[model samples]
Target chain A: MTLVLESQLPLLIVMLTLGTVAKVRTVGSGGEPGALSRLGPAVLVPGRMQAPALLVCAAGELVLAAGLLVSTHPFFRWGTVAFFAMSTYVLLELRRRRPDAGCGCFGEVSSAPVGWRSIGRTVALTGLAAVSVWSPVTGWAAAAGWVIAGPPPWYAAAGVALLALLSPEIEELIDRVRYRAPCEQRHGPAESVTLSKLRSSGTWRAHHQDLVSAEPYDSWRELCWRFFAFRNHEDDDVVFAVYLSGRRPAVRMAVVSREGSDSLPDYIPVSA
Target chain B: MGHPSVERRRVLAAAVLGRTGAVPGADPGDEEPLRAVVGEVLDVSPHLITIETPGGVQERLVIAPWATAWNGSDTTPGDLSVGSMVLMRTLRDGRVVERIWADTTRITGTILSITGKKDLTVELDCGPHRGHRSVVIPYRASGRLQVRHPQFEPGYLFDAIGIRRDGASLALLPATSQPPYPARSVPPPPPAYAGTLSRIAGTATWSDTFDEEERGAAYPMLERTDTGCPKTGVSCAGLPYLAVGSLLQVRNVCSNRSANVPVVACGCMAGRFCDRCVECDTSPRGRIAELSPSSYVELGGELIKGCFNAQIGLG
Candidate 1:
């Protein structure tokens, strides 16, 4: 039973490390508000401070993970148990109050709203951490002690099975593997897909008024992009290329001069 | 892939800011090149290079000894990265490349607001993906821009062709004629032809929204109750009722080329533009079919030029 309890320490360390990396990466590259904003505790933090708060949480997880890997001290064990216990409580509150938001245990991948499976995983992690509070050896020591073992103890197998059953992210991994074909090679998107993406792009809206006719004069696809051309008010060709993949397909535009030259005269800046 | 060097970025920044000494002269070619090829670079060699054009055709062009390549600024052809988008100008031979612009970027959107007293700064709403961006209209170009864009207010649309510096887009040249009206006031299109016909005579276009090898057409008109169709009203008047898998016998009036293609995707977008095609002669001002790139080429349509006067019937 001691060995089984120690074995769970590595699992906690790994989960903590993953969470730390994901959170830190999200905070480092600033863009849209991350999954942290959707978590229940977000209401307590200002929008500008959300990233910093996520970084702080990640720092705590890293410290706990590093502490558990090298030391079997009661303090480290108890801290880990407390961390997961707090996590379980937070997830429960999120589920009850903001059912539409995720616990944000991971980063963007955890943006899938609070679910029974996520809460179950947190609860199971808390139980695992509680059992590891009595471990006598560090996570690294327990891992080293498993040299050519006949089989893991029944409890280790049971713990792994429970964690697997509670992890809904596994289905996404399976789907990715099942449909691994490149975007262009797959049965391409519908015409409406490219058109809608083009319409939503900044390039389209900017040049929309200059178009001579209401509809695109010509359009064609090449690889992962669909190109649409329209004559501008100046009779020059205004062409747009919409990327055929991703949630927001990238759109590009080029205006060919009526004389067919690729170059447009430079704009000479002067006081307005 | 390797990115444009910092020195090149600085040069592009200077060029965009209208400080012109760092900018290089245009590619050493005729004033008017026959074609401008836009595509992603696939393969490159010292003497030869290949690119997948927007029409999905892999074009192999001879890299002229004098061919100039620019990413953010003047660069060597060897420095061009695979998978980077490029705009190339070919010499008269139509096979030898004379110029290449790599990773060229463009910005088009509505002017949300304007700031700055000397060098005017314009904030643009570049739609959802790009969100908002701020561009500097260099003092040198401000006068010319204001003359062209008279109503440079918040509601009017703005456009510029430029390059990306770091992660931000820098607007270099006006990409299109600026309309004086608000973007929301685009003139309504003439009503689409609503009547049905057995043989539709109109412009046929191509879209790359399908496998390159697949031969098919996306008919603008469909049976009202067809599964997989969004149940939108018929897109064009001349189109006959067609199903998803129906066959279309298409002929290009200009080339006299013909083929039978299947209906593989939707052409709801094509129905919106009621405009004529003057490829050979004037085609009726409504799109009848949107063909896959391969099928479009097979029916003697040049993908870059965009359309062909087409006649189609149920096959």
Candidate 2:
């Protein structure tokens, strides 16, 4: 097969290999995507586990990329280092206490990380590729392709992989713009009550007001909020979490009509 | 932020014969002067009381309008009226009598802007000079030293006296505490569109047409308004267009400090939720209120500095 065809076909085989891994979800977080348990399921998939798949894929990638090098085309060779580096980084992230679970590498295909076994697989496969590099026939062919393809395959693959790593941050920011605050609100007739609205209002304040109130937050974080409901045995009281820049001196409420201005100001939390 | 300051100030004040250093003792001298636990009032006109000193003599003497008496309740003393039982200085033809805490700060606002007709568009932050973020002393008969003073534009800083503190801000001092700064030397043109925080340091005398029909006094522009907003979103009485905690975007006319602020509570009368607090603390306002306008307010950036309208990058 042609270098491109070999490389392309192996990518599919790798996908097929990974597809066999059973996806698992941790029971604790419900279905909330907290972190790496995302990849846990797929890694623990009964049949075509991650390590084997990565092994096949990396091996395929190495062979195809080497073939490309033999054709004196160094453009795709760097993919070798990139694939391995990404595999390693993902493994590390998965092992973290706060695992970065969103390891969606296959685009709309899957988000599971290739797993720990991937290390051994990569090591074995890379060694094979290295061994092949010394063969007289293989050497000459690889040399011819490398000389013709500009630099070596490592440069191209490494560059492409590096680009892949950073693109997510840019993409994430772009996605955030879509969730802008619903401005110019007509207020929807000002609903008096609702569970959805109630929670949303408080959630919004807790997010945004967290910044205003000594709490650690910024206004943007509180996009929507719900009113907090405090129930007494007799009546349902709604108390606004009044925002103030107060120190824990005391909680006294008093009003002072400041000088030079017509504004009547009140300070809460004093010698009550 | 208090106690000592209150003590020193009280010590600097006329001596009291009966009361202890503050801890509820008799003011020091004489027949323990007269002490009454009456309801808080506005003005103690026609009569006043004298605070006794340890030396059996009354000294420094407080002015009636200058003192404030509090009512033992959750209610604010601002609700008290001149007819309310206020602690005051009994004076005979402005002579010494007694010093009592009256029911008022008597000073407010740091003047942010000034208008013609002696009306001062000030930033109401606290008592006395609390909200007057800028000083607009009546420099000339023609009002040359008013809001649009030639030598006192947005960037020009001037010295002013008689400023006081308010909630979490400062106001213009009385004609007394004026600190010194310079005028623009040349006339400063008013900003194109000013925000509430951009008010000049002079007094504003606006006649509300609403008051012409609803209330009698112009209510000092925003002297007093209802706190609990009508849930119907239909404004009729003295309530604001928006309720407390409602989000608002304020733009400083001069420096353009614009940001979305969650309505903490209502400012005296600035439109919308003009407060911008990063924390829910009462002390900042108390401290800021004690500062004089000339001592605290800067002529640059948002005329009012401590509001959350400043946190979201407005200042």
Highest TM-score: which candidate?
1
Tens-place lDDT per residue, model 2, B1-315, is: 112122122211111111122222212232223322212332333344333332344433333444333332223333434433233333343244333322222323333444544534333223221234432333332243233234333333332222122332122322221212221121111222212222112111111111111111111111121232211221111121333323333322233322232233223322111111232221111010111111111111111222211111111
Model 1's CAPRI class is: incorrect
- The lowest-lDDT stretch of 10 consecutive residues in candidate 1 chain A is A263-272
| Residues B145-224, model 1: lDDT tens digits | 67757778897777655555555555555543465545543322232232334476888876545553456777766433
For candidate 1, the chain B TM-score comes to: 0.46
Point out where model 1 deviates above 4 Å.
A27-44, A148-150, A180-272, B1-315
Could you give the DockQ of candidate 2? 0.02
Evaluated with DockQ, which candidate comes out highest?
2
**Candidate 2 residue-wise lDDT, A1-272, digit = tens:** 13322222222223323323212112222221222234432343333354344344434554654454354333333444455455555555555632434343332123433344344444433333333332333334444555676655553344334433533433444443544223211122122232223233433333333222322111100112211223222321212222211221121111212132232222222231
lDDT of 2: 0.28
Query: A136-231 in candidate 1: lDDT tens per residue?
Result: 888888767775565656677688788889876667556646655444323346666678777876666766998888576544443355556567
